[model samples]
Target: MDEISLLEQGVSFVLHIDQHLFALVAEYGAWLYAFLFLIVFCETGLVVTPFLPGDSLLFAAGTVAGAGHLSYPLCMAVLLGAAVLGDAVNYEIGRHVGPSIFSRETRFLNKQHLLKAHAFYERHGGKAIILARFIPIVRTFAPFVAGIALMSPVKFLSFNITGAILWVAGLVSAGYFLGNIPVVKNNFSVVIYGIIIVSVLPVVIEFIRANLKK
Candidate 1:
């Protein structure tokens, strides 16, 4: 799918996750926490899947945490572990299976595109694992690209951990802080959009910068 279509899917998935959070909290609260953690992992780890919610889910989970319906520390731990491990797993996959994946006749993915991702990841391998924390599509695909390029595990780990901690901390804190206000508490959907824009801001800035330089 196109970038716009993928973004729409991301928003839809996040909204669905949010709408179901109350029921999820009621029926199987702890499991829902794990479920959300897994969703974040898959969205960031798997190159073929960007449909899962990332920013919005984290923020919503944080809001729930502040309400004391969920334990904030526990949620933070689960999500942090998931995000870090997910990228590590994807890095391994790209290292070993990337070529085979590129050889396949997939409509949405191409070997040339994979090479481009690889080169970009190579030139900015450290940032691939770090800055990706802020970008939507880049965050989802960056690890996969790193794998394709066989980035050093030690280097990847260093940057991956840093990014995971900062990304989770920032989003969760935003939820914890802003979620308490009367306006924010009532208009949660606006917060979701704000998270998306924040997530995309880096990409938008880079795009503008490249244009200005040209």
Candidate 2:
């Protein structure tokens, strides 16, 4: 598919994850768990796939689970594992490529994003690993930048695991509890957009702050 079509499909999925995800779970049955795992993995693990649904998907999954369509424990476990493993793989890839990779530009990779993530890492140090988990594009690039900076594997793993757990659990649990409310369930699109806005707020604030400093 072309870029515009791909973008549109992704947006649609995120906005209507409730309906699309329910149909997926219903049709795929047990395999839906694996599918979700792959989606989460790609979104966090691959820089080029940052546009893939992340926060919204998890929320929708939790909503479905709350409705008794899927097992919450199993859903949580699968996604959490995918997220941790994805970051580990991304970090390893960056470590192998080193900092030089960031100097080169490609259609799939954005240099500005790498620079922003690198700066975020430098300013926040180790905490950037956890903080980036809440930001969309940065979340994908943070581990790679950490690896380029040659962060210790043990140190990276500690924060990576912690962030993954907190991110997945917090969003999913919120959907489970809040999504079940009559108002929320009836107007889930609004809640999903709210989640998206809140998720990206940090990046927006940082962008503004950087410009102000300039």
Candidate 3:
């Protein structure tokens, strides 16, 4: 497929991840674990790929595990590792070159998103590392911003590990426990949409609050 076609397919897959994940698990079996790891890693690790699925992906993985197609402990471990490692890489990149790239919005980098993440980090301090895990774009940039601000490695790692554990375990557990229910199963797409909305709701509120002050 061409780039545009591939991009379209990717967008569709993310939007309907609950369905696509099932197909992935069925076709790839054990390899699905690696796929999940990559998706989680890139989504958290790369600044430009924030649009990738995170919250819904975990939840869908949990649901798959709940169906006995995958192992819960293994899923949690792989995803948690991916999340932490991704942030660590992103932090390092930021520490090394944040100033140069952040000077202007490049074709790939969105300066506004970085600024928003920086503002969040400023307001919440180290806690933003934990809180940003639940927010979409902010989570992708929070660690990078932290690195730019010269946050200590020990402190960033502590918060990064804690946030990854909570983010993976909480959402995955929710899906494991609830995703197979008749209501959720029949309306899986709706549930994914709900998860995305809930994940970004804080950002929406923050934006509104910021505008009100302006």
Candidate 4:
């Protein structure tokens, strides 16, 4: 598909994730797992794809699994790995790009700034990485920034694995256990919009607070 077509489809998927997921389950059947895996991976991995569905997708997948169309345990495993590996890859990319930007001063960028960022990330990377996993868009950029700041791989991995487990298991299990409720099932799109808002609420609050401080 062309870029515009892809963008339109992506937007449609995000807005109607539950309906699209149901259609996917109907059409792709077993192959839906791979699609889910890719969505989770890209949403978590690529900075450009922060717009892709994460929380809602997981919940919808869990709902499908709960309905017996998919396997819950397997889905959890697949997504957990995708989440972790995606962050890892993003970190590596940032790590590689960071040095070049820092090796020399630009008209606008300075080595001292990068040094301060590195120091800040070193001190707070662990908690930030774990917490960021729950917040949309922030989760996508947190690890990349950590890498740009050169957070320790060992420390990053520990928190990355822990956060991925909690994020995938917690949301998916919520859907598995609760998604079938008549009210949630009937209002799945509303629930999805609510999830997206809640996921980004922290970022929104922080932005508002920063603006007020200024």
Candidate 5:
């Protein structure tokens, strides 16, 4: 097996890579936190890449904090900033790129999706961006979709701020609290596994419903 492919190794493999750099991440904890945040931000912010492990990573990081390796408050702060900044950047990208989507020659991009995002924007309006924080892949796609539809910038920011705070605070706190349980402490991997499964449920349900309706 190859030693360094995300495909071959999966999340555990990636965490091993994170562990290798744990010492360095710990040395400049804030920077490390920000670095992880950016990745999460980009993953959520970019429509092309909505598969990042925002939930699992946050939970695992919180668990790490519970063990005294990382500071919980700092971890929360960094991840929150990452979550918020990610949305903001993604919103800007959408705002700028929306018109280009109008061109006929755009490859692999669908105008219908932009329309759909707009529809979603209308139904849920701004809160979708913020509420989307709880769901895994959707959180990433929401902003991009919103931007593609040219959602109002001020409205996006309002929900984005609310969602960022709630999203980050909720997940971090979940880990901090549950992670300290005796069973959870001993079975961190099990907990993380469950988190991953739960995180993906929203996407799965939507996928199934979409197919079923057709």
Candidate 6:
């Protein structure tokens, strides 16, 4: 599909995840678990697929679990595993590709993003791995940059595991607890949009700050 079409579909999916999620679970049954795993994996694992819905998807999954359509434990486990393993694979790819590939801009990957990820890594140290988990685009690029920078494998894995647990479990739990509230449930589309805005807010602020500096 074209870029605009893909963008529209992504927006629709995020806004209506609550509506579609239960139907998917019911129709796919246990396979839905594997599907979610793949979604989470591709979102983090592939640089070009960074635009995939990660945060909203997790929240929707948790909401489904809250409604008793799926097991919370199983959902969390599969998602958590996908997230950590995804980062691991991404890091390895970056390590293998080295930093040279990022020297030039591409249709899918931007050199400026790599620079930002590098600066983020430098400023935050290993903690960037954890912090990036909460950010949108940065979350996808952080591990790859970490590998390109040749961060110690041991330290990277430690932060990766910790971040995955906190990110996956924390967001999922938030949805489980807050999603069922009458107000939240009634306006979940708004909540999903809010989540998207909040997730990207940091990047927006950073961009503005950089422009001001320039």
Q: Candidate 5 on 1-214: residue-level lDDT in tens?
A: 6756756567664444325335656687556666667767766666656656677667667666766767888888888778878888888887787667666655544455455455556667678787678776567667877776777888888888888888777777877777678887677667766766776686577669868999
lDDT of 6 by residue, 38-111 (tens): 99999888877878889999998999899888899999999999999999998998898847776666777866
TM-score of each: 0.84, 0.96, 0.94, 0.84, 0.78, 0.94
- Backbone clashes per model, in order? 1, 0, 0, 0, 1, 0
Candidate-wise lDDT, in order = 0.78, 0.90, 0.91, 0.80, 0.70, 0.89
Q: Which ten residues in a row have the lowest lDDT in candidate 6?
A: 98-107
- Residue-wise lDDT of candidate 3 within 1-214, one digit each (tens)? 6999999897678667877878988898999999999999999999999988899899999998888888999988999999999999999988998978777669998899999999999999999999999999999999999999999999999999999999999999998889899999898878888898899899999889999999
Better of 4 and 5 by lDDT: 4
Candidate 5, superposed: residue stretches over 4 Å from native: 1-5, 14-31, 102-123
C-alpha displacement of 191 in model 6, angstroms?
0.5
Which residue pairs collide, candidate 6? none
Q: Find the number of clashing residue pairs for candidate 1.
A: 1
After superposition, candidate 1 runs with Cα above 4 Å error: 1-19, 102-104, 108-120, 208-214
How displaced is residue 180 in candidate 4, in Å? 1.6
Q: Which has the greatest TM-score?
A: 2
Arranged by lDDT with the best first, the candidates are 3, 2, 6, 4, 1, 5
Model 2 earns a TM-score of 0.96
Better of 1 and 5 by TM-score: 1
Model 6 quality (TM-score): 0.94
Clashing pairs in 4: none
Each prediction's RMSD over C-alphas, in Å, is 3.5, 1.3, 1.8, 4.6, 3.6, 1.5
How far off is residue 146 in model 2, in Å?
0.6
In lDDT terms, which candidate is top? 3
